[model samples]
Target: MPQDCERTPVVRDNGRHQWEKDRARAPRTVRATTGATERDTGLHPPDLVFHAEYRELPAPCPLAEAFGVPAGTLLLERSYRTRYGPESAPFALVTSYLVRGMIAANPDLLDATNEPWPGGTQSQLHTVGIELDRVEERLTARAPTPAEARDLDLPSGAPVIQLRKTSYDIDDRVVNIADVTLPADRTELLFTTRLERW
Candidate 1:
């Protein structure tokens, strides 16, 4: 997809020009110089679409433990699956959590129908006057559950890389947490940090 502000032709209605987003293009997760998935391997971009939905939980789960929240705390859980073109396997599975109380001021944030938000979570938080300061990701690898293996179409013995991403605001309060599952054979993780010289 053209990255640098490629404009689609305007359509006219009642002699008024209307701008429409190009929906055929695959959705992107983050900014990348090349392709989003090619940071380490220069892999070609796959035809992909991201599907997301809100999950209802009866009680606090692992996410609550990671966030140090009390059990049974109500959280907004959003689950995502990215699938490649004409393929039964998914590129990855990702789920994100946010405290419902933190964003209750913006009713739009609570609805799944408003998802695939134009600017992602940062934009969503901006609506509520929150600014993100930094993000941290913890990583681990493990065997997939039988259901995961079936969903990902992994070969026997294939591992999956799991990531727990935490986002903090300028006040240093946790704003968001995300769990990601990546097919070990096709995914890569890269981290860069800058340091000041003495």
Candidate 2:
């Protein structure tokens, strides 16, 4: 139940690591900074395993509104589960949505076969000429649903953190939206802001 895991923003600068290319590679340890602090802990990307599933579906009214699209507009939904090991529960449940028309120019984006994408969502959007301007994450905690509790292997009374991440393009349009569910028992959220000297 200790908050032992750390999560941080993946900036464009950390060029795709080699582990992203070979999932079966031997475990390679990396350091992860603790929440809002400089303390580091060992983490292994190679030890984590994941699967992705993609589908095209009509955008629900709320989703359409978020994307500023017409109700029922086709959207690409990508779901992913990445666990510490083959037999472990997922670290987080992630679902991402993108407006189909916006990325249809790149047919590859519509296919799941091309996933485990080198640079992840930002890079995928780049293939269609979309440059990200900013990413906003809103976090909230609540009791997990029966399915979520089971999927995340939560102990009784343990809550889950629901994070809604909204990505905006350089033009200020919402380009992608993702909902991530993390087990509160092991997760830590960090936020840092730098202000220019007045």
Candidate 3:
């Protein structure tokens, strides 16, 4: 997050010419039904390829308003949509989402940490997640290849973001699950963290 870190246009918007068209280039293929499903047959992959449907989250849930964050923050939310085929049931396992807070910009945060490689902009909290040389907060326990952009569940396009997270299930006095880990191979799992910005 630099002092001038800027927003990039998403492929879906008109901002990127040919982007939307490129993303939707080919329709997913549907396999023809093998008479087996009609008979008392064994299981098989669906005749239709798996797909996801997104309905943008409504304005402010209780959890969001509690923070009193600003407007136009890019919010991430877990969807409960259903489907029958794919590499796996990718979305159901997610427990949280991310939304940009409505706060003024700050990029001087770049030089504060011990990260060896401070990527392009090291100012914003969310973008800071990727800029880190590696996880040092003890929270970033899982590591995956950069190419494993799985969370969006879309078939193509470079994900605008990537995240690695760990969760703590605190119940009363005992820590039942300390830093229970969750990685967004396809969809990011965004929970609140106590770390400072940048």
By TM-score, who's the top model here? Answer: 2
Task: Give the C-alpha miss distance for residue 98 in model 3, angstroms.
Answer: 2.5
Q: On lDDT, who's better, 1 or 2?
A: 2
Rank all candidate structures by their lDDT, best first, as comma-separated numbers: 2, 1, 3
lDDT of 2 by residue, 1-198 (tens): 222444332221111212222221222232121110112113344655658899999999999999999999999999988665544577679999999999999999999887656446766777788877677778899999999998887778999999898889889999999998987877756555557999
Sort all candidates by TM-score, best to worst. Answer: 2, 1, 3
Model 3 CA lDDT for position 37: 17
* Candidate 3 local lDDT, 30-111, one digit each (tens): 1123211111112343422233222234336443443234443344332222222333322222223333222114333222
Q: What is the C-alpha lDDT of each candidate?
A: 0.64, 0.70, 0.27
Whole-structure CA lDDT of model 3: 0.27
How do the residues 118-177 of candidate 1 rate in per-residue lDDT, one tens digit apiece? 546766777798777677778899999998878777777889888787888889888889
Better of 1 and 3 by lDDT: 1
- List pairs with backbone clashes in candidate 2: none
